[model samples]
Target: MLGPDPRTTLVWALLLDWLGQLLILALIVWIPPALDWSIGGTQLAGQYPWILFCVLLYPLLGWLFGSYTVLHWRRLPMLVLIQRLLLTAAATLAAVAIARWLINPGEEVWLVYRRVQVVWLVSLSGWSLLVRLGLRQGMLLPDTPRLLLLAGDEERDRVLQAWRRVPQRERLRPIQPQQLEAELSRLDVAMVLTLSPKIHRDPALRSVFQHLETADPRWIRVVSPERLFEAMQERLPPALLAEQGLNYDDLPWAVTFSIQAQLKRAADFLVAALLLLLTSPLIALAALLIWWDDRGPIFYVQERSGWLGRPFTVLKLRTMAVQSPGSPATWTQLGDRRITRVGGWLRRVRLDELPQLLNVLNGEMSLIGPRPERPELEEELEQHIPHYRKRHWMRPGLSGWAQVCAPYASSIEDSDLKLSYDLYYLRHFSTWLDLMILFRTIKTVLKAGGR
Candidate 1:
């Protein structure tokens, strides 16, 4: 149902969450004083720094943990509430630990700190849960603002099934052609028409939608069912690619050629340089381990496809024995015998990719984008997957949307799925998306589940 825009709902949810946290903090201070408890050498006003830290740190953690993502909000209210509470608790503990370490509170202050932190954690979690539950029930109630989906017989069932999976399903009612006008008039309706050549050419249906638009311009939308499926799955289907008139040659070069491209490159270089400096000791340790594994070379270098299908040498810490003279390139399977014990651990922790930061610094890759494929693999994928080569329109990346969302590709089908993620990234390329990918990538590494 077209209740509120997802982005608008997210903004409101965040506002309510922040306000709840603030109110809870205020209560923690006021209620304790009312109980005659000592505040340990500080007045309520003096606690502004802690309050400020909560204000900034909680929301940052929430965003990182997917609390602000709209898809989560579209789930069952109880599920969303539980997820938010857990995330809030985690964030609170982290913020409190960081604060304790940074401030190094004295004994008396430490007592006060522990007391306030416990109260804040409970109050904030409870309050945020109540706020989100209220929002879900009030604004996202499943009885108003109904959605009417229009599609051919073949497409209608697929579209209806998709809508049924969302929390708004109760408000989604499919209307037959004969009942369209009556239903539209009787309900607070938002109409979604699946785009197709046949539907586009139907003047009568066009007139009906045009009339609806005139009455409520923003309530009527034309969307491709395939695009909807792609979004839901986070992977482009071949049929959707064909239906949407997408072409490999139409790759969004504007993203690569624009001012943001310059900013992206600058960001890449600066972040790469900083990371390389910070990671120098770790890199040295990894190299030592590799060398000590079997007296083999410490670095592995191989040719890979890059921007605009150019070739560049990609570098990694050696993760396998030196190949026999004529061994062919192949995917790394799980528990492959080629992996040395030290190399396996390094790969798990993603230390092997630390060297690719140098590639970022060298302008051969981005800090975030589609991962570069090897030349032979790229050629094979391009042959099997439509528009696969379009991923090269931008610089390949150290970590990407596909890397975060999908497992490593081992076959043509897997490669196709990865390409869909790449296409999604290409279509929606932005600094914010890049940041999200980077955050998810960090989570993946911390869990030691390498792609």
Candidate 2:
């Protein structure tokens, strides 16, 4: 807590950034008329927030992206900060474009928006780099924030004990009741951890909060412990579930039902279709090699668990020598003797799993999810491993968080390691996270790190 409050500085910085944008909006309206380049003579003022919305979205998006975090914002390099801000700007502009399309603004309105956006894109690019660089750097901003824990007398010890356990305890400056007003005036604390609901009942503290409502409420963010946990949620590994007091039952959606799910389905279908098409020639070549390698079948189909514990036949290019009837379903060992020469190469390149794209298209799998297991093996795993069936909560995928993040699982201990990543994925399923897995899968395949 020795330097500028990054969150407070961020607020001041963004206020300045937004003011520049507002001024730019005004100039776009004024400059055209002054230079006699007028188109329909300025209706931007009349458009209100409709036209001003994009300018406003700039800071809101920044907050959403945590561009101004309590700790890391000050330490972020100029290039990294610019990259984050640019992403926010891109998202804002995309919203603007979508809004314009949806509204179908008339010719003059459309022209005004297009011109303003073009100018904004060009000008703001230079603005952040030059004009706002110092502000974002927070070199000129004032005050170092203390981490405040708001607890009544009864709960103060409990709160302090909990606070001491967190790594951020170094930032706790311990503001006494009398010094609260002074701290507020100096903007010395940006976050208040309310450990007790009734702790804010003091007449002075209540007045301070009421003042916050009237003044800039951005400075002091009131955070309940639950809200803090919720913010920290989304990507909890199975290993940490006990520590976090969470269990497999906490993961929502027996079968995920939402727009996010539908979008995921659409993306899986489209990406799988495209990948299947693009890799057809490679798949054919691999199939021919596998046939020639051992005179075995090109495709191997096996019963595997799917979403909601449903059993489905999964398709894959055979990469193992044919097994005898009634052979136990066992994990293939590294450098297993059963793997044919060409099959080993196929596994190494992950080309053997290419046929699973058909499974993805058939809605039995996803482009990214927990890797499914053979039903026989899955039953054994369920018997021995806690929460093993939870992996089947989401649809099986050709590649997944577990598949990419973890190495090949031939042992129960290895499966446990992979399951942790799989649980993390289930906890934090999002479009962005799915895209991350997809990229990692591509990298793995490129590195021939498969099997």
Candidate 1 all-Cα RMSD = 4.6
TM-score of each: 0.78, 0.50
Give lDDT for model 2.
0.67
Please, what are the lDDT tens digits per residue for candidate 2 over residues 158-253? 445433332341344445566666666755445443434566666657776676556455566555443432343222333324444435455543
Instruction: List the candidate 1 regions with Cα displacement exceeding 4 Å.
Output: 1-10, 38-42, 61-91, 94-98, 106-112, 135-186, 202-215, 226-238, 242-252, 255-257, 292-295, 320-325, 332-345, 446-449
lDDT of 1 by residue, 1-451 (tens): 2344455567777888788877776666576667887643335545566667777777767666665653344465567557766876776677777777888755544323666677666777777666666665656433234445566666566456544433342344555666767755653555554454445466778766676666554555555655554444445544346634565445444744667667788999999999999999999999999999899999998899999899999999998988987678888888889999889999887989999998998899999989988897777777788878778878999999889877778888778777878887887777888897988888667767783
Candidate 2 at 91: error in angstroms? 33
Pairs of residues at least 3 apart in sequence or in different chains that clash in candidate 1: none
Q: In model 2, which range of ten residues has the least summed lDDT?
A: 228-237
